[model samples]
Target chain A: MLKIENVTVKSEDKVILENFHLEIQPGEIHALMGQNGAGKSTIAKVLLRDSHYDVQGMISFHNKDLLAMNTTDVAREGMFLVMQNPIEIAGVSNAELLRTALNDRGKNTGNILEFHRELTEYCKRLELPTSFVHRDVNFNMSGGEKKKNELLHLWMLKPNFLILDEIDSGLDVDSLKLVARSLVEYYEAYHPSILVITHQKTLLDILKPQFVHVLKDKHIIKSGDFSLAEQIFQDGFGASTMRNGETNE
Target chain B: MNRIIVEQEEVFLQDESVFFTEIPNSLVLHVKGNVCLALTSIHHMEVYLEKGSHFLLEAFVFMKNQTSKIVFHNEDDVVLDFHLSCLYEGENTLEVNSLVDKERVRNYIRVRSVERFGSLLIKATGEILENTRDAFYLEDIQSLTTHQERVKIIPNLLVSSNEAICNHNATITHVREEELFYLRGLGIEEEKATQLIKDGFLKSILQIEEIKK
Candidate 1:
């Protein structure tokens, strides 16, 4: 469903991603494991067309040139990137933002009442208060709440390709389970392709990504199955790099 | 204090009472005791407060091409609060002057608006006499405009007393960048996101539910 080839990313004078490449099929879940400053988040930003960095080479979505599209166009074409730190905007309510997004998707505009009813229901499952619908988006919310709020958008938007960046960070054990359950449900219902960048074994265990790739120094250096994630957790990123297969480590 | 709803173009308040005026012009009020006044779509006004009195003005402007001036005098142990919300097209000028003469006097004012093809000028001045003790004055003004809207605000605080506390702030701009990014990240087009931001900015002033009823 997604392909990246010879993609080089750079920010001003520094090289962030050097000739990076990856591939994902329909309904496949991929886990990207790396330590801090390993350029894991950069890939998400690059795919979303973040204007801060410069990208080259080809990224194809459904055999279409994805790199040429703007951020909104990419999003409208069924790609969603859940940000690591969801920004807070004062005065803009969560319900309003969600409503605009659902309407822009063009598929959910038939029934206004049903849209709100479903959104409120999703908020309840995420343990969000009903008042959250009227509250400003991400304003004064705790880290866990912000993550759940991002997930709320993910469910409401229902993009075909999902990119989750550090979604498990700052989540307590209970919220982690709830989020994992939400992801599993989304996968079962929509069968969308998923790519998760994370360090937590508990979250990986829940979603159970089909393939795991280790990212280091701005490129993917190793590729393996779910056990690679377990090894990375136990032996650390540096040690697990030596035991990986399907790549020249 | 009696509660009365104003239904005329001109209103005069000489006694202690709560006045609710909708769309009035030329108001002259003198409060000897305590008064709570709500003015909606008022065009012109002058207000004066006597010693040991309290006054609150909730003024909303939804008219085009209006000019207004309001002056308040505070004697000993007097308090005044002014809240304003304006949304309309064309040019508007609102001037406010407040004077505090003796001890334990306080005044506060705040104005907010969102407009299109609108020009607004707001000038607010506060003066505390040297003989006054423990006087306080504060004013906060903010305007968010879109599509060829113009706004200029000047808040002046003149204090001759050492024990007086005075401050003022004025901010005028369109939807901010980070705010736009936060909305556009959700797949909303730029124009629609800007409209949403504009709507949220003016929601507090519009009072949609109250108007719907």
Candidate 2:
């Protein structure tokens, strides 16, 4: 469970998120839909404790104050963010990197043979080739392959809270389905809380989010069940505008 | 320290023979005749492998003191494999020159190879120093043999190579920025990411058997 209260974040003398508030419960998928520049990615970056912005407010994870923790500490506390664009490290192989990551979190006990066997099985289920384990992370990979690699990290780390920032943007139809299905399976198995920020609704069709919150003008305008997402899709954000005069022109 | 003088037009070749053996400080080797010398130096000394006759020379210099030089002259059908390394805290220099008669009858030579028709020149220099200067040179005349000559140079200097070879190449690149960002996003710190890159680079170089032992 995570909570953000009256979060005000500014970057480069420009206000990104002002007085934002959101609560995510355990074992729930929250779909955050917003137009471009609605500070959707900003929220994810703040949750990841990125130092690029000057933030003022309180962010808590499982009742522990999150704003005070560094990036590694945040990760060790079971938070993982899959970026919009995955990075490509040239010579660092995926298995080696994953092993280091796992070891850093005290999840690896130095059983390399067992680790390889488990990683191979995980890759097989994710429809990835075994050779990908030896290849450098995301280097020279196609757009679809990059997306799949992100999912591979998710499966490997198994963090408590997952934030996916526009993960389905450049993915093709097949890759989108693969990524969405993996998230659904992960939720069913591990039941980790997820915050999915996207503009498209096709991915939500696979995950079937528990709640949909429409973000506008650096704040949530509406919160409703899964039908709210369908309604916004059939109509538009203007169709579900609240009676409150908080709507921006 | 005692010294051994090698005269010209002489061949010093024996099975398991050590020239400049146990010499402490200075070694003067004067060459004039056709000479073949296979010498190994255990202490730091100045060595001259000069050539006047058709010669074959193989010298291995290990753990030198102040400085060491391997100077040679015109010879035919000559094979040279020079392995020079320094472990002391002093300066060292290795100068090598192979002069061949380009206009005379074509002679065949190989440095670090076997069964090659043309002439071959091989120079191997390895140094492990705290504060010292180590140098390697290979000079030759053009148009002597029909075969192509190949030169392979492997230099590993931990500190600096100031005013050394103009072809000095130093590869000390940091990790990719994108990789650092990706790792940070995954909850790994920037320091850990950089250490991983350094470890990977050193591991690749350590894979060489000659360098590992």
Candidate 3:
């Protein structure tokens, strides 16, 4: 479970997220939908303490202050953010990274052979070739491949909370299905809470998120079930005209 | 700190012979005649190749004061490929110079070096003689430095031939911040992440496919 209360994020002289708030319960999948530049990804960046922003307000994970934690420390506390544009890192292989992550989290107990076997099986489930295991992380990978690689990390890290930032943007139809199925399977098996940020209805249709929150004007302006997402798809975020937790705009 | 002179000439062969040896100190080798040779070592060596010949050289060495000067002369057709991997620690200067003389012949030269460490100066020069037709040269130097230790890498290509194709590129970089962030985001601690990046940087250069096992 994660909670953000009246968080305001600013960079230099510009306000990115003002009075932004979000809360996710355990085993609940929440979708954050917004137009471009609506501070959807900014929430994820703030949670990770990306260091580029100046943040105010309280962000807590399981009653502990998440805002006070460093990025790696927050990750060690079982938070994983699937970045919008996964970085390309040359010379670091996927297997090496996965092993380091697993080992650091004390999930893999130095059994490299067992880890490799498990990773290969996960790659198969994700419809990725095992050769990707040895290749550098996201180096020269297609956009869909990069998304799948993020899912691979999810499978390997198995965090308590997963934040996916525009994870459906560049995926092809099949890759979208694969990613959706992986997300559902991961949730079903691990019961980790998820916050999916997107503007795609196709992705929402796959994951079937329980709660859909519309991010607008630097805050969550509307919250409802999946129908709200469908309504937004039909009408638009502009049609809401509702302020945060208020009936009137 | 000793030196050795190795000279060979008047030998004509058509098959490829490989010498895989590690020599300490410094060496000067003069090789001539018509032959195709492959030499793999971890020491300083100045080699001269004459007549129509093809030579392949490989040096996988951790440096502690090493220097080399190599020259090639071809009246017919000659090819040279040099691959080096170096690791520098503390303070050191490694200088290497290469010259190719092309006279009515076809020549190919390629030098690839991957150097890592701090407080090191790597000077590499490649030159092609004038009136040389159909000569090509490539020089690639990469440097990885950590800490405040300084790295000065100079890769020079001097081509005087009108019919020569030469390229020289040098890049000196610390560990990239984005790369470090990507690793740390996966929960890898800082020091371990740096070591992993360094390992990857070094191993990526070895283009070996098959193991002799």
Candidate 4:
């Protein structure tokens, strides 16, 4: 459903990703595991067409070039990226944000009352308080609350391709379980292609990724199965990437 | 001049009622309600209140080519809450007088406070054009009381005025370059970043009033 071919991304006169190529079929959960400054997040940003990077090569979703589309257009084409640090826009309520997203997809507008009712139910399942809907988007919320709020947007919008950027970080045990279960349920229901990026292996254990890619030195050094994540957890990427050597052909 | 005096101990409660008056002299009114008072050429108006008399006074003044003034006087141990807004686009000269002569004189002009449990909002908006010199004088005297006043005056003045409070403070500033760069680093464009700042400012004002209402 998504393809990236020989893409190189540079930011601030430094190479972040070089010749990175990957493809994900529909209903596949691809987990990207790498250490700090390993260009994992940079890959996500590049795919989102972030202007900070001077990008080269092709990134297409359903055969449509992603680099040519604006952020709103990319969003309209069923691509959603949950940021690592979600921005808090003070006066814009969560409900209004969801309404805009739903309306942008040309969904049913007359079912707003039903939509709000369903949102409350979803928030309750996610252990978010009922007042979360009325509060401003992620404004003054706790870390766990912000993660849950992002999950709330995921449940409401239900985009085609979901990019989870280190969403497991800084979450409590209960929140992590809730977020994991929510993703599992969402994948089971809609089966949207998912990309879970993380340095930790705990969430990967729960989500059970199909493919694992190791990003290092501005490129993907190794691509393997979910067992590769456990091997990295046990032996660490330092020895694995050293054995694999600088480049993967 | 028909003068209706509100006695010191009188309590007026009129709900959903309309009052029409052509009174030229000062009308000492102590009214409490969901009421509307339509007055023409009202001069020297004084409204006094007693203790625990919940009142709402809405004075609509229509001064056509005449000098008109409305004065408000608050009594001791009384809560005089007023919301006064005028649309002065005529050639007539109009002046508003607000006086707080007692303790606990809380004035909430243009914006309301969510922290305070019980507060008063005195909001006014006026637009004057075509050689109209309008004066809005707010004299707030407080002793052991708190007053919060916010005023917004939007006038497209063709001619300058020295007699009125014509201190026009106009400012045009672009978004900070650092803020723009920060947003751009997050993949937001320069145009979208500028729009976000403008929308944030406008949305904050509207949100405050929405909470007040």
Please give each candidate's TM-score: 0.85, 0.62, 0.86, 0.61
Better of 2 and 3 by TM-score: 3
Give fnat of each prediction, in order.
Answer: 0.48, 0.46, 0.61, 0.09
Off by over 4 Å in 2: A240-249, B1-178, B200-213
Summed over model 3, clashes come to 0
In TM-score terms, candidate 1 sits at: 0.85
Kindly report which residue pairs in candidate 1 clash with one another.
none
| lDDT by residue for model 3 (B33-82), tens | 44334444444556666556565555555665444444444444666666
C-alpha lDDT values of all predictions:
0.80, 0.62, 0.74, 0.61
Across A1-249, the per-residue lDDT of candidate 4 in tens digits comes to 899999888888887789888999999999998889888877877776666789889989888998897665666677777778777766667776677556656776568789889899999989899899888777789888998998888888778898999998889888889899998999999999999998777799999999998888777778888988888999888756653444444
Clashing pairs in 3: none
Model 3 chain A lDDT-worst window of ten: A240-249
Ordered from best to worst TM-score, the candidate numbers read 3, 1, 2, 4
Off by over 4 Å in 1: A108-112, A242-249, B1-10, B14-26, B62-69, B87-94, B115-121, B144-152, B172-174, B202-213
What are the per-model numbers of colliding residue pairs? 0, 6, 0, 0
Candidate order, lDDT descending: 1, 3, 2, 4
Query: DockQ of every model listed?
Result: 0.46, 0.28, 0.55, 0.10
Local error of candidate 2 at B121, Å? 31
lDDT winner between 3 and 4, please give it. Answer: 3
